[model samples]
Target: MNSPMFTRTSQQESAIQTNKVLRNTYALLSMTLLWSALVAGVSMAMNLPRPNIIIMLVGFYGLLFLTEKNRNNSMGLVFTFLFTGFLGYTTGPLIGAYVSADMGDLVVTALGGTALSFLAASAYALTTKRDLSMLGGLMLSLFVVLVVGMVASIFFQSPVLSLALSSLFIVFSTMAILMTTQGIIRGGETNYISATITLYVSIYNLFISLLSILGIMNDD
Candidate 1:
């Protein structure tokens, strides 16, 4: 019953809305990244110890849940910051250890690599015409495999496994960036908050994975 003009207008409106969400998501992502870095700097300056694993996991998942639960409200922003800040705090001790061990350059290298990977992935996603929504299932499968590997590595204490997992993480994180960005552009992701979280998590994992790989290589 809709006229051609009406359909065109609806498409235009949807495009505008998608653009707005993408812009907002990037803005919020930048702020959260800066905030997280600042918190990490403070933690490093104080030489804070890494938090216990159980507490860190609990806090992370709990805040993530709260953020998702409140995604439609202003409270989601609050929870988002809380979640990222906690991650930053946890990252500080790891960075500090590297610096204290005179491996600061390794950290810088990892940072640079992570940034480049993200930019490459995002640019590809933006420019490509191919549909990436099909990657959803693949990404989820890889994530589950990674989680299992991580848990097994923890118990097995195998450096080879650790290195392999880090490599896989890099691949997973890059695909995640591509998939999430394409989703935003394709109108599959309407919530800026959720999009920001996904992108932030991708970037965070990319950085950590790069750091781990670099550290391992440097030690060898």
Candidate 2:
């Protein structure tokens, strides 16, 4: 029963809303990335040890839960920063170890690779007309597999398993970036906070995965 004009107007409004969410998500993501980097630098300077795995899991999941619960409010931003800062603190010790061992170039290479991958994935997502929502279920399945593999690697302490996990992470993170960006554009995701968190986590995983792969290669 809607007129053509009305339908057009609705589409325009939807597009505007989508654009706004995308802009806000990217802006907040940039700030959080900078904040996380600063926290990591401080942790490195202090030579802070990485927290135990149990503590790391509790902190990460707890903060993530809080952020999702507060996604509609201003507190979401606070929790987002806390979540990212916590991750930065965890990463600092790893980076410090690499630097201490004269593997600083590996970190730089991983960082560059991560950035390039993100940009390429994002650009493709934005331009592609294909629906990416179908990827959601597959991504979830991959995530479960990833978690199991990570736990197995922890107990077995196998370099081969670790390397395989790292490669899988790279694939998973790239797909995540593409899927998240397309979800934002297609109106599947409306909350900028949630969108930003997804992208940030993807980027973080990409960097960590690349770093792990590079480190393994260097060791051989």
Q: For each candidate, what TM-score against the reference?
A: 0.97, 0.97
Off by over 4 Å in 2: none
Which stretches in model 1 have alpha-carbon errors above 4 Å? none
Tell me how many residue pairs clash in candidate 1: 0
lDDT of 2 by residue, 66-110 (tens): 999999999999999999999999999999999999999999999
Each model's C-alpha lDDT?
A: 0.93, 0.93
- Model 1 / residue 164 / CA error / Å: 0.7
Residue-wise C-alpha lDDT for candidate 1, range 1-220, written one tens digit per residue: 9999999999999999999999999999999999999999999999999989899889999999999999999999999999999999999999999999999999999899989998999999999999988888988899899999989997998878989999999888888899889999999889999999989999999999999988888873
- Candidate 1 accuracy as TM-score: 0.97
Which stretch of 10 consecutive residues in model 1 shows the poorest summed lDDT?
211-220
Which residue pairs collide in model 1, if any? Answer: none
